[model samples]
Target: MRIYTRKGDDGTTGLYFGGRVAKDSALPTAYGTVDEAQAFIGLARAEAEPGSELDQLLVAIERDLWVLMADLATDETNRAKLVAGETLVTDAMVASLERRIDDLSARFTMPSEFVVPGGNRVAAALDVARTVVRRAERDSLAAAAPGSRVVAYLNRLSDLLWTMARWQEGDSLTARAVAPLAGEAEKGA
Candidate 1:
């Protein structure tokens, strides 16, 4: 089959179980941002040790994003077609993230101040994914159904990403200011 269907050439994209909407619409924009986050999570997974816990966890999160995107892509008309934990985001998914966050947080000493990213390549990639997830959460707010859990899942996913980055980094760098050089101090005086 040809890769290009030319369906979206008209500036509209297909939805999950049915219908289509403009390419720039809320659902597409939200799911597109989620797709971006999933790619970054893949980058972090690549940096993680093969078959290791971090790698395995990232793989799970990446898979979950597909479910999330499915939830986001489906219009309200087809909402009844979505199955929990399959094509829809569920409370259990958010709870799982919370559990993972607690577990990973317990494995490390929480930093007292705001963290600076780039503690390591894997951690830095995770940090990047976390920020993208934050954006996805914000975008999902506009696209989610009244009682949908997509936004909650994205919110918890970001927290989990932050915890994972800190776990991988061992010692996270703080955003606190450092002492100035002697010449700078003299100039100030």
Candidate 2:
């Protein structure tokens, strides 16, 4: 059980199965981004109002992110066979996030402007989590197999992060500017 197997000294790492891959492989990138999101989620939880709903929800998010990281750690074939029944991220997970997002977004004014990702410590960390979640979404999409749920979870998780930040911090905390995204309005339309 030595921590140093010395196997990855040359930029290669072992996966859950017997397979190995380069350190910079796509699966790792997805997991790394998810890990970054989870760390930022932890930061938000620590800074949020103690025992509040937001803090409780973030703790749940961190647990789900760990599950996502585990899925991404394995190769596609082994990932398909993983038997962690309740731990798997699912469409119902996406629905739960939607409920949370809608609950928070109701307090905010929808905008076509770009807002800075800082205000309160919790909010800022949540914003960081949002961007990392976005990266995780893209990377997971790239890593996704035909029936994978990882990418979808990341997509919804990022949206949840945005609304959670606005909830924990006031909407006015987000700065005003032009929209960074084009055709964003049309998508909502």
Candidate 3:
């Protein structure tokens, strides 16, 4: 009933099914980063209109992160216990993200160059989430099993986050849009 178990005080944390590992171990690090990304996604969701498509989509993604964290938290010994689309990352999940990315990308004029993040509050939050998702993706690589789809899911999730941020921004400002530095202009002259 109480939240604090005082179990992790020893610097090790419990996995989903069973077993423990250091708090800084690869699986914990990966899932912890996924938790962070989910929080930022919540911030973006809060900024969206209630009942809006963006809000709904963010809610779904947030729920998916729970499944992802569960997948990452389970050790290889208990890997067989994971349920696809529930406790484990599934191909359907990755494909769903890809489909959303394509749909959202179709709604906007894709920027030809790198984008500056702060276009608006929701978009900015989405951008921050996207970056965290990227970090999660990298971390998952070290934690994932050889045939695990966790890494693939994180990879596609990051891409979907990028596309969502762009969709929320309406018009993304590309890196090329920045004015030349005064000294650079003088040097060119």
Candidate 4:
């Protein structure tokens, strides 16, 4: 298995299930943007505190993104490989993200003005990741070419990231506004 297949030298590449398309094809763009998102998450993770929750969340998100890439990698013949990943980027994922955004918001300060994108290395890196995520969402939607659930997921994910950044910046969201913890109210009382 040589890495240099030279098949893509002519501005074309093979998909996951023996399908060939242009390098800039929609399928590639969709999955390729996912790859980009994962790379940015890696960078952000490296810059984040070693054991911070944000760091951990990014790790999980990156893992999910790999699954997403697999899902997006359909062959040229529309004969997809067994993707193994969650074929649907479900509403639950979106809800989970909203919960996370709320959790971070509860402990941070909300911002009204635009952010400068640099409170620390992690923050800066996260900002970069957020932008890339937005771009990925755009590209993914373009590739979807219709009302796609995955595209909607990406859009929400980007907003989640933006809110997460602000949350990291000390914008505190209320506990009630977020998902209620199992014993949080009891503890507070």
Best by TM-score: 3
Off by over 4 Å in 4: 75-87, 145-147, 171-189
Q: Write the per-residue lDDT of candidate 3 for residues 73-182, one digit (tens) a residue.
A: 99999999999999999999999999999998888788876676777899889889989999999999999877888889888888888888888778544423755779
After TM-score superposition, the amount by which residue 61's alpha carbon in candidate 2 deviates from its true location, in angstroms, is 0.4
Candidate 3 wrongly placed segments (more than 4 Å) = 171-177, 185-189
Q: For residues 20-82, what per-residue lDDT tens digits would candidate 1 score against the true structure?
A: 999999999999999999999999999999999998999999999999999999999999999
**Candidates sorted by TM-score, best first:** 3, 1, 2, 4
**Which window of 10 residues has the lowest lDDT sum in candidate 1?**
171-180
Per residue, candidate 2 scores C-alpha lDDT tens digits across 25-142 of 8877778788888988898888888889888999988887877777777786676566452435677777777888888788876545455667578889888889988988988877
Ranking by lDDT: 1, 3, 2, 4
**Residue 74 in model 4: shift from native, Å?**
1.6
TM-score computed on alpha carbons, candidate 4: 0.77
As for candidate 4, its clashing pairs are: 105-173, 106-173, 108-170, 108-171, 108-172, 109-170, 109-171, 109-172, 110-171
Query: Per-residue CA lDDT of candidate 4, range 77-137, in tens?
Result: 4523343336435567667777877776666667645566665566667778788888887
**Could you tell me how far off, in angstroms, the CA of residue 15 lies in candidate 4 after the best superposition?**
1.9
Among all windows of ten consecutive residues in candidate 4, which has the lowest summed lDDT? 171-180
